[model samples]
Target: MRKWLTGAVLGYFLYGLFVYWYIYMGGPDSIPEQFKGTSADPGTFMNSRELLLSGEYSRLRNFMYFITVPYEWFILLNVLLTGLSRKMEQWSDSIAKPDFLKTSIYLFWLSLIVTVCVLPVEWINYRISLSYQITTQSTTGWMKDQVIDFWVNFLLMALLVSVLFWLIRKYQKRWWLIAWTLSIPFSLFLMFIQPVVIDPLYNDFYPLENKELEEKILALADKADIPAEHVYEVNMSEKTNALNAYVTGIGSNSRIVLWDTTLNRLKEDEILFIMAHEMGHYVMKHIYVGIAGYLLLTLAGLYAIDKLSSAVIRNWGSILKIDSKKQIAALPLILILIGALTFASDPLTNTVSRYQEKSADMYAIQLTNNKEAAVSSFQELSKAGLSQVHPPFLIKLFRYSHPTILERILYLEEYHAEEQLKESQD
Candidate 1:
């Protein structure tokens, strides 16, 4: 037991060191000169002084994410959740209810505890965003959103856990395979319904009001061979100032969605470039590819969880009062293990996502034949989103889902003009 505890401690610190290296360690200094800052033409680079943000803006935001996020996810939550799980197990035994119901009750309590424990850090994040004018949602609005998120998560978790535990109890030895198979369809169902069903719960969505811009976007979609029936605009300005647009869902539900902030802030050409980028995602079949990757990861993660959690519960069952995997009280142990696994796998996910994003970027430039628009769009994005121009190598490796704005800009500068000339000649 002592050795196990020592190993756990060592593992946590080692993970922390790895995280520190990724976020703080070796990286390029700044964006390459040609795409360093705002430029009038495609290839012109701005002065270095104009390319980077002032120290005040950069450091504080960087610290908020680089320090706060890791501390909460890795250290505080892990410790708090472990202790909370043990107490929940003890409380469940005392309640003297049916097995499944007892598990449900334990999960309900555990979720509530987690939400409460994390609320302060969430609040700090919001406060920082608010200070930067990134989030415009008032405290009341934010709280309402939180309540909605909490209930939605709790209900889904209840249903999922009930189903999973049922399978475990029934199959005893092969539940992991059953659960993994079930999750594939479940994941697809969620994706299919996300844009239409779940997303509208938080924000109002409407068909894009800009007829001319919508027509242009649709033209781009047609060029990309995607059936973009109608462009949707979400009321993002109600909550945030950040600009974003994406292609989401599958089949009939699939469409392009632009944040109202993006529509309102960006030029028509920039909007076209953005729409083309999202269209590229559809044309490239990245959504399907991403889903396939996730399915494999999910299977592997569930298998690992099954193997590890069984051994863990076997060893600590007497002390933790967890009799079986079917017990709701065992969830925390399962969750903690899953969390660690997910963290470890982040770089792989990020790498794939970044590659897709870069592909989409190239596709956007090709479809639009407007290097200047793409570069300017990126500049606006970095300014609006407060993106790091040149993040540390580790941060890019583990945290960034897409290429850094600066990297994207520099990349576009290299090939945009050549692609445009080829298109013109063709």
Candidate 2:
């Protein structure tokens, strides 16, 4: 066990070292001269000071990206191999009378333990955001959010784990299939409730206060044949300076939301473009597609876990103190496999997400026909978020769900030029 833990720590350290080198030492020396001063200046999007700040911010963010996954895996592995999971299982069993109660108690401990283990990393991330002026939330407010997040996660996970264990004991080998089938509706239920129920817990949400802008957005939605009645805005400025808008939920619960920061920072035309991009997602049915994709992935992952867990128990059951898949003590093993598989699948999932985003971008451009607003909206997004216009290949592969700001701007520019040239010919 010590050997396994040592190797994991060493491997993660080396990986972190490589990530540091790639971010700070190996990447291009500066933002390409083309992108340095285009938007406000004659030929670049950002000034020298902005460029320097963005570069530093991007490096730290990317470094966290590389380290977080392995750190999570290591934490789970340590819990499993050090007999902590078994101990927790025993404690839960002693304290609870009913099977469901026992399962919930065990899951609660597991969630709390993992959250405690990862708190420092979470703190570092929060501190980085604070230093970068990305977030203005006080530490007390942040910790409050963290506590809220923990309970929410614990509740959801406890329910899932209870059902999973029940399925495991009943069907054994077929548990994965049954669990996957159950998760379909379960996942949809979460999505349905998220906007109306879950989101309001974090921030105050209300109708967009600017009646004129709201009317314009509703008009745009009507033009697109969408049934949206009102645009919603969330009080995000109190938390972060980043600009964003998104579509959430489905059917009656479905709505488009704008962050107050987006409304404050962007011009009317720019805000419209952003809204159009989100509307594209709604019209395109990306949310339904995403749900389908998630269900399919969950199906495959649960199956893989079923086989892998059995094999691990057969091989290392004695050392790990996990005798069977039915044991709640196997939760760490299950989570470890899930974490590792999710990490392995990041590139493929990110690629699909990026494609969806690009399609939405094009849709927004065509619907709005405002190339300047579209381009400048992206530039402001980058500036507000300190986003890397050109991240490294690995970072882009694993982390980027949307195209870089530079890519979106260039695509808009090119498409507009093509349209103009065709009009001239006509």
Candidate 3:
């Protein structure tokens, strides 16, 4: 048992090491060939780091990122870990899936428990978040919000777990194929509903009063070739001190979202830079590409698990004190599955996301050329959030979807420098 456990754990560690190595080397060789020497303006530009140390900047960066970074990391890790352990069990010699109906019921109940537990823990974490002086919620307010949050998580979990498990059973050996088919629409569905249904749960969305800023964004989107339906603002400050903006939904749900805090907080040019970055994602079709990549990765994982079968399950199931052959493995199966998936695939995922961000940054820089906004936005984001200016490489690979602000600023400064060199020659 020790030998098997040692091998599995060691293998996992080695995989992590490989990911770090891959990302560390992400320095320059990873730059897409098409993007090489592509800047039309290569002007030397200064960074806003020192400026961010000023008073108001502090209010924005840390507080906002606290919730954003953790929330994204937490949910994503849960999903990946569940997938990994399930596949590991499938590869094991011991995996004995619960009977179809019973398996579905068991997995659903376990998911419900996991879903509900998140509320209290998250509320406690919210309290800890307040210790930072960036949060806006009082104890009573927090509890009320937690109640709303609980039901939101419950519904999302129920749907995701139930549908996913049933799909697994339906396809059985061919689960990968079915998953791919469903994931496409699921991505779109989340995109569509999130603006109205999911987002309002966290913060209130209000119509933007500034027709000028709204018009400005719409014009820039047109100039950038960013397809648009409409642009709007959410009253983000009503809930938290954090300032943020996002581009979510597709088709009818596809709308441009700017945080009311951001509009109130950042200057017009800075806001434009932020908007252009999101436009880059839309113009680049990142959503469809991400969905496709997710399908492929998920299918590959299930296929990997099918090859191994049961031995993986018995080994860890025993170690974890989970029932070896009974339906209890269903939950452990789900948990470990998520953990292992994260352990295996996180590196590749982070790399791809980083690349997309770089591309987005390029587009933003091109449209605005307001290097001041780029730098100011960073300071604003950093000060508001209290973000770790620099993170351990492992954390970045495992957790962050967007490039670290420092890395992003560095990229902007580098591109800005190259543009200056070319212009001097002209």
Candidate 4:
């Protein structure tokens, strides 16, 4: 057991070192040929290169990522050492009269323990964001959001965990399959209501007030046959300087959301290109495809977890005081295993996301047929977001959900070259 634990600890650090080395030490050669190069604009190129190694950038990146290893291990180690989960379960059983009340109290206290333990790290991350001028939210406002988020998570987890354990108790061996079947509707229910029900709790959103921009975005939607009516603008400048735009929801709920910062900082044409790209997401039905993919992965993960957790309980049930699969106290162990699985699968998931993003970029170029607009939009976004132009290869592999800024710009250049050749031939 000690040897197995030692090997797991060593393996985690070794994997992290490998990722860091591939990204920073391997340098440009680590990146694929098709994924290399910067924008043609000399000013953009110079600025990107400078910012990539800037002190503030380095501080922000390091501060954000450096805690991940220790923080993850801390959650698992603290839970195991202190036996917090088992204590919570025992306390809940003693005081609570009913199963529902017991489960709710147990989940609330457990989540609170986890949250309080991690609060310092969360605050430091927020402070770094503020120091870097990435976030505009006040400390008070941030605390408010944190409180709200905690309650939201606690409530959701209470419901879901209660249902999960109930299924486990009832079905035993087939619990995972039943749980997987149940998650599909709950997942869709959340998605369908999130934009309307949940989003308003965090930020104010309104229809894009600029009539001209709204008309233009709608016109692009029409061209793409996307059935979008009104573009939504989120009040994100109040909290962040990050530029972003996305399409979310389905059917009547479907809409494009532009960050206020995007509208304030970028040109009309650049915004148009962004809107077009979001429209591509809608037209391509990426959301549905993404949901389907997630369901499959979730099913597989649950099946594997069921098998692995049984093995774990068989080996260490007495030590951990977790004698049965139905016990809420086993959640910490389950979380640790899930975290390891997620970390291992990052590259595969990121690859799929990057591929979808590339397709959206191409669709935006084709829909708008304004290669210059597409190119300039990417350059502006990279500059405003302080995106790393040449991220380490391993970072691109495991962390990047979209193609790097350099890769996007290079692809636009290639697309423009092909368009120009076709024009000359015609």
lDDT of each: 0.77, 0.88, 0.63, 0.79
Residue-by-residue lDDT tens digits, candidate 3, 1-426: 456446545655665455445434432222234433333111112235433332223223323333333333344234324454344334432443444444444445445555564555566567656765557777887777767766675566556655665665566667656766776678678778888888887777766679888888889998987666467888767656667777777776677789877888889999999999989888898877887887788777766654433455555445443433232345454445555675668789989998998898898999889776887787577566655444555556666678876677778888889999999999
lDDT leader: 2
**Model 4, residue 153: C-alpha shift (Å):** 0.7
Alpha-carbon RMSD, each predicted model: 3.8, 1.8, 8.6, 2.9
* Tens-digit lDDT track of model 2 for 110-204: 78788998899999999999999998899998998999899888888888888999999999979999999889888889999999899888899
lDDT by residue (216-239, candidate 1, tens digit) is 888888888877779999999999
TM-score of each: 0.86, 0.96, 0.71, 0.91
Give the higher-lDDT candidate: 2 or 4. Answer: 2
The number of clashing residue pairs in each candidate reads: 1, 6, 48, 1
Task: Flag the better candidate by TM-score, 1 or 2.
Answer: 2
Best of the two (1, 3) by TM-score: 1
TM-score of model 4 (CA atoms): 0.91
User: Model 3 off-target regions past 4 Å?
Assistant: 1-121, 163-171, 305-309, 314-329
Model 4 misplaced regions, further than 4 Å = 1-59
> Sorted by lDDT, highest first, which candidate order results?
2, 4, 1, 3
| Residue 335 miss distance in model 4 (angstroms) | 1.6
Where model 1 places Cα greater than 4 Å from the true spot, the runs are 1-29, 32-87, 90-100, 315-323, 420-426
